[model samples]
Target chain A: MRPPLIQLQGLTRTYGRGDAAVSALRGIDLTLFSGDFLAVMGASGSGKSTLMNILGCLDTPSGGHYGFESIAVETLNQTQRALLRRHRLGFVFQGFNLLARTSARENVELPLLYRGLPAARRRQAALAALDLVGLSDRAGHTPAELSGGQQQRVAIARAIVTDPAVLLADEPTGNLDTARSHAIMELLTRLNRERGLTIIMVTHEEEMAAYAGRTLHLRDGLIDRDSAEPDATSCC
Target chain B: MLLNALLLALREIRRNLLRSLLTVLGIVIGVAAVITLVTLGNGATLMVKQQISALGSNLVVMRPGQRLGPGHDEAGAPAFRREDADAIAAEIRGVASVAPVVSSTVTLVAGAANWSSSVTGTTNAYFAAGNWTLAQGRLFSDDEEQAGKAVCVIGQTVRAKLFAGEAPLGNTLRVRAFGCEVIGVLAAKGQGAMGMDQDDTVLMPLATAQRRLTNSRAVGTVMISLKDGVSASTAIADITALMRERRRLTTAQENNFSLMDTRQIAETLSGTIGTMTTLLGAVAAVSLLVGGIGIMNIMLVSVTERTREIGIRLAIGATGREVLTQFLTEAVALSACGGLAGIGLALLACLGLAAALNMPFLFNPGINGLAFGVSAGIGVIFGYMPARRAAALDPIEALRRE
Candidate 1:
């Protein structure tokens, strides 16, 4: 009976103008409830990243309705959208975009810094997040000093430092080897199961998607299938 | 937010230390040049004024030439006589004293030492009109001047050259054709405003020089002193009228004498120094502007180089304004540090130059502070465009730059 965490109705996005225009997303209607773990899978140019961008408030829909909780997100100004990201949304990038020379602890504290948290509280929260990702011992190490998997863990810690409402990850484990990728998926599954945190991830690997409770596949700017149904591949 | 941005800026600067220093070198040179030039110029002006004041306050010189500069035909001009000086001393209301001076350069021999020095002949009142003081021994008495005695006062340079370590007073020194007794030693006055050595002279009574050395009654120049609080213009008018009548000049005839006020000379010299300082300061300020442009150029390149980092910050929740403030803060910090280094460099240069030139070190707080403030302002002015460009970048597009 509670409202969904995110709702997208007839979402559409276009790249350019007139004859040169390329449609990246077309009429994406979806609802993500609280505590849901959803995986989005698609070939290249299938608008999975575009949907993630809109959901994270990093991009606006050209024509559609997007609601976050009870507020209409498409009508929010730039400042409001930035505030939404600051307070509610966390992001994990494919490249583990940690500031180059900064230590792991300082990198994790960035979100709280933007939120203007007190230094003491920011340090405490960042340390706790690092502890959660098992990177507390590597707090003083920079990204160059850490392994690929360790760096991704630090990025995850940074993403969750503010305890955001939802974690939006774009290929969070795409750059890892098979063993490291499995370990990251296991961590995500544990975080979802133990903390009841909502997560939406974009990945091309079916093995990574298998960790999610539900999966959606996109083709040519439209959702081709939803794995929640029994015969989803037949429909596609 | 400011503290966060400042911390980040400092980190960035530290990471690119060599590049940052190179970027601010222009500002350093510009600020240093301006401060050094202005400080030395002011010191020179002050020295000129002080030398002029040393010639005596409210003093005027009457020379018998129509032209003022060097190479004028003084041979054809009528020279001033002792009667003209006596007439001004007796007739003018604000006149304090008058002394007729006749100077000639001659070689003086004292035992083994011989030196060329200027010998000036005037009465005891010349010491009062010209503010000359004796370092030792007494000045010549009125009886000595009336009787045309061969007694003189030697300046410090003459004493150093001829007497060396011996006592100069009551010593006999040969002047041109005859020997004169040194009755007193004048105090050291260093150098004159025109770079002449002031202490290389000998002073004697006017009657002695007129009767023995030159055998002429015409005086070279007449020095006038005015009473306290009396204007020089009033004294000049009075003396000009008296001189015309004394010389029998009709109404239509042009006056053959020229009057020079010490105050006017000081003003003119100081004005010239001030104009030169301004011109040099302007040139230095242009270098400052060039330095500012260098900062802008570096900042633009930095923004482009860090586009992906900017995108990362934006994606992590930093507002465009926050990113803009960070970049601007970096620029301002760079220029301000450059300004501070420039001030240090300028102070060192000024100290060395002042010592070398034998001028006092004058610190003008106004110009130093203004230079510092302008450098910081230059940072803001030049940094704005690049910061705006960085802030205006689209997050997705920036992230895609790799």
Candidate 2:
């Protein structure tokens, strides 16, 4: 019913040149709509990280057509891509990359700070984002003072503080215990259902992928399977 | 964005305060050295010029030697007599006054106080020629000087040592075989051109000194002062010609005398001081440059250590330019703080040293401001490369670093 928010065609990423070249992604063709919750799974060398990096605009594909909301992403320059990320994309790293020794509130305010928002509004929005992640009470606590799960929550708050169109997460619960991993997944699920936020996650855990509306498995840099059947033309 | 960068820089500095302090120590020392040396050097130069001028800019001294420097062979030269002084006073057109002088070191006893001091013999005209002003009492009278009366004018230091707060005027001072009455006390002149105390001697008439101290009629020096609007070179030529003719020196014979211009001495001494100041300033500036290199080295290390943080910022949409600005701001901030600290330290050091060395405390705003500006400029010059490195880092690769 809705147009696709992201479209990728013939995406290929290769590291190095000539004899030492290693192809991280052979080719990938996919279309994702707004509010879609997708999980990507693969083995260690299956290029899941490379694909996520390309999707996050942190790396450019060797050859590809990447369209974000009908705009060609591959044609954008580095500064343009950074601007795209600043205004429309959000990211959560596997390491929960919160600045060490910084409070959760300031961490959340970072995006707004980059956006050049006024201090008063940055503070209000950061507080609101922290509250959404259920971390309002620990907003003043630094990463070292917080638990792993709480740190992940703060990272999520930082990611969503700018209200970006898509949230790309790389193994968001990789370092958490079982109960904490489940708790983070439940929080993601709640954010998806209540706020209708679009999320693309990379994980190897089956249970974590089970929470997403769709799952794609990769083997040897190619899609092994797609859990949901497409209603449009399919390549595989 | 700049505000954010500044805050980040300040926070980073505060995080490792000790390391930050150590990193800027080179800059602090460099700036402090420059300011202190220049300030003291300037003070010394001013003191020298003042002391030289105090000897009277228009005055010249005639000594019986080929030159005024070391190893001068004045042994064969004839000493000047008081008649030569009288001849110059009468024959020289521009001569305002002339006083024949002879000096000898003698120990004098006044009450319980005893001091070893140089006793100078000259006419009352010596007061005007040497720019000596009376702080109390009166100068030698015509009758006193002509009769070679035993009346002396004590210098301030001599009064302090020999009189000890007691009224020196009309008091008798023992000088060799004769007892001279103190008729006046000269005003204090702190230090002379050669760092010697000027106010540590006694003055008497030419005849009195020759009779009581030297036991000879030889005048060791002839001080001549020129009238206002008179050319020193012209007057010197006239005086040299007259002296040479009186001594019956032919054109083939070298004049067996030297002339000392107070203004010339001032110029030579000031030039020497200026050269020394420049040399020391250059050395200090090298330290400043080395300090800049130190900043660059530390900044490079900082960029390496904060690679992950840079990656995080980049991933969250920070542009390369923003990252560059952040690192540059940190460097500039660190160096600027060092500059301020150096200025404060130099102020204290200059004050203490000026007092200890008995030099004036001369505060030079231009040098202080220039030092600060240069130190900050060093930040920009040395910070650029490391900042560019930080900005050029690939987000993916940087994040991959452990």
Candidate 3:
């Protein structure tokens, strides 16, 4: 069998210290292979966001072994972590955090700019990414001028522009209505199938989870259920 | 990366054009005040030096009484006679020439044009002692001066006022009761150091003035010119000693006369004006620091306002350094624009003031360049704190800010 693309064994995350210390993740053991689309779901404060942040390298686990490919993530310094994020990870936020007053194409080019790509190639790559998201004609439109769904499309385009190894999305469609949410989910589904892009998403909605190949439910800092483990029962 | 950061900064500034301009207004006024004050001060100092030098090279004027300037009241002091001028010319080693002057205000009539002006009486040595040059015609001949002939040389102002457009050479100019022939005209000397009109006077023979005008043998003042390379202090000491001996002043008595050195007066005036210029410049420089504080205030506000934008950049793989550079570049761009505008404004102000004050407009590149460099430096100094604050923001917290 091919080795797992990501491995987290006995991972734990705690905020603050001493009597005020609170555990966000409690001994999470998980494995993800390349091309797998996973969805994480839980109620508010159920540790789903914490797990996502650790996986995305935006936060360090207090105790754990987080192995991405062959690199030990928790051992990396802040600058090294940033470099890993810059070269391998992409993020999509719930609010569609595109730079205000900036053109859609320029928004898509942001990651490439951090990559230090030349201007002409950055333009070409940004346009291609915009085309993939069906925003070729709206490339010049700023975030304020674009619709909510279009802005989310631009956000997705920006995330995938650098060809990152994993796209970690935090409630990618939390602000959208049912129709637009499904439309965005469809776009994510197409990117997963056509480009074979690995995606790990956090959401509280079952409908959004349906688009993923597998689902993991969290309850009070521990995994209550994993869809891959079909025999497991919900703890709550 | 620097170019990209600069482009982003410019875009941000362009989006908030009016606010950026208002933010830099303090810098604009500060730099303008500094350059204008220094430039005008330099012009005034130059004018004073030029006017004093125009009085004569190595020239000294000895007047009765120890006080100088207005309300001197020299009536109690004894006046020097014509013999005193001869005595100084013969006794002093550095003395090149001496002229005894007996001046009186008189009304002159030339072709129905009557004007009141001071008349100076002396020998041909007066021309050498006071640095006078004839614009037209000739100086008084020895025979004309010795015989007390009615001949005079009018100054440019007197020529312009009394003669108008007509030439006054050989024309009879009536002095009170008698008439003197206009033998020559003195070149225009413009204004004196004390703002008096230097060209509004007439020069006549000592015998002529004594006989026709003052009706006295006493000379009111003695003008002395020293030879080249003579130390003025030494000459002044020698002349003072000789005059004291001739006036019969004892060792216990204070000499009833004062000496005025034109060169020393020039140095004192220039020194005072230079100090004043430095003081004004220092005050203006403080305003520059205040302008820098203004920049810091606006930059802090800008960082707080753009916290969300900073968060977006960080989340998308931007390093803290990049964010810091972006905000710092914005601040420097704002101040540099203010600096350029200030330099332009100062040039216009200096030109207008120079013309209005009748002073030379000396363009000093060193000060302009220094001002611009200092303004740009203020940007770096005032920009660092805000940039660091922006860089230190947490991605999670910043993204949550509205």
Candidate 4:
């Protein structure tokens, strides 16, 4: 049996101090194995976003024990965490935070550049990433010229270009319309099913959550439910 | 990595061409002003020294006593006489040549055209002592000097003015009412030490000047030339002591004479010009400092603009040091472009002025290297803070920014 890719125990993420101290995540225990497409759902400020950040290594939990593929996360220094993030995780954001005034291909190449790849190799990897996103034809088109859906796809390509162990997305389809959101979710589902990649996503919409293999519901930082959606198979 | 940063920097500056040009204008004007003024000052000092050296020796002139006006003052010392001139020449130990001179302006009537010129009285030794060379014919004879004969020689400009494009040697030109024969035409002297027209003069026997022109036995002043390998200080002291003994100068009064040294004048003028050049170079350097400030200001704006970009880069595996190096490289590239433009402008200005002013073009390697080196240094110094800020940005916060 393979080790769990993500293990969170006694995760209590707090904010502020004194009487104003608020726990974003309170005493949550969770395990996510490889190839698991889990959706985290909550209302606005219900700690879904905070949970996503901690899972993606974007933010450190105030109090928690997080083990990723048997590596202790809470004990790691900043540089070590950053290195772990670079080598093991990927992130897609709601805003599609691609570099402006730069082309789709170049934006994808940015991650590889930080990887310290050679110039020619950087360009080749960027091209392959664009191809995977099916935006190879629009490789040279800047973010300003690309559509909202196309831009998000480019962002997705950048996130996965480093070939991280798991992909974590936050409100990845929040900016899209119904059809585009379905298309993006369908792309996410295909990557999980075919690549067998572990994925965790945060969203408030039940419709988007149904696409994942499992759903974890949160209310006031505590896990309220952890179950497979009845309609999850149909969406997949 | 440097190339990428530099390319971005170049693109940014290119996008803001008008502002970049305006910024460089300050440097251009400042550098041009410095180079022109400094070169002119150097040239002026050299010109003065050349004119002074052409005078041949440490020469001193006595124009009667200390003059209240421009002309001779005969109050303190009696008017210079040929007898006193002979007495000084024979008695002064360090004096090589003690020739008396009297000058007057008169119109010389040649064939048809008439030219107004000055006739100076001096002996044959005047040419050797004054460093005058003959262009044609011969110099005045010793018999002409002693017998007070009416003979004269003409300078180049006087030759041209009187002869009017004709060979003037052995020709008679009317000096006032007396006709004097031009024995020789002196070499072209261009302008004099005081920027006056030295060539526009005639040299005549000093005796002839007193006997024919003024009909007086007195001269306007005495010209004394010291011998080679002689020190003016010691000679001046000996002459002062002897002249005092001869004229009975009482201990109560000041030496009623002014001593003029060409070397002292040259040194004073050179020192003043050097000071001016230093000041001009300093002013130019101040503009470069302002240019550095402009670089800093723009870099701050760039860091703010690229904050989100910095965050994204950090998230993508870029270290803080990488981000810092990127911004620093951009700043350096910007300044390197400006520095190159400035140097080109300075060279153009230097060449233009060289041709316009007829000065020899001199390209100083030291200043050029200094300008480029200082420009790069300005980039590094001014570019640090913004680079550090970019490096220190929190990737999470920056990426989350709307």
**Candidate ordering by lDDT (highest first):** 2, 1, 3, 4
- TM-score against truth, every candidate: 0.91, 0.87, 0.86, 0.77
Tens digit per residue, CA lDDT, model 1, B2-45: 99888888888888999999999999999999999999999999
Task: Report the C-alpha lDDT of model 2 over A1-236, residue by residue, as the tens digit.
Answer: 77799998989999999999999999998899888999999999999999999999999989979989978998998888888889999999889989898999999998898999989999999999999989899989999999999999999999999999999999999999989999999999998889989999999999999999999888888888887764323745
What is candidate 2's DockQ? 0.65
Per-residue lDDT of model 3, residues B1-402, tens digit only: 888878888888899999899988988988888888888888888889998998887988889998765566687899888898899899999888899999999999998899999999998899888888899999999999889999999999999999998988989999999999999999888888878898999999999999888888889999999998898899889988998988889999997998878887788788888899889988998988998899999999999999988888888888888888888898898888888888999999999999998898888888888888888889889999999999898877887898
> What is the C-alpha local distance difference test score of candidate 3?
0.90
Q: Output per-candidate TM-scores for chain A, rounded to 2 decimals.
A: 0.96, 0.96, 0.97, 0.94
Rank order (by DockQ, best first): 1, 2, 3, 4
Candidate 4 DockQ, CA atoms: 0.37
lDDT of 2 at B153: 97
Among residues 3 or more apart in sequence or in different chains, the pairs in candidate 3 whose N, CA or C atoms overlap within 3 Å are none
User: Which 10-residue window of candidate 3 chain B scores lowest in summed lDDT?
Assistant: B66-75
Off by over 4 Å in 3: A1-5, A69-71, A75-77, A231-236, B49-96, B99-118, B143-151, B165-182, B205-267
Query: What DockQ values do the models have?
Result: 0.65, 0.65, 0.54, 0.37
- Model 4 earns a TM-score of 0.77
Model 1 score (lDDT): 0.91
Please name the candidate that would achieve the greatest DockQ relative to the true structure: 1
* Backbone clashes in model 2, listed as residue pairs: none
Interface RMSD of each: 0.9, 0.8, 1.1, 2.0
Candidate 3 lDDT over A77-125, as tens digits, reads 7667777888888899999999898999999998888888999999999
**Residue ranges of candidate 4 with Cα displaced over 4 Å:** A1-36, A54-89, A193-198, A227-236, B15-131, B146-152, B170-181, B189-268, B400-402
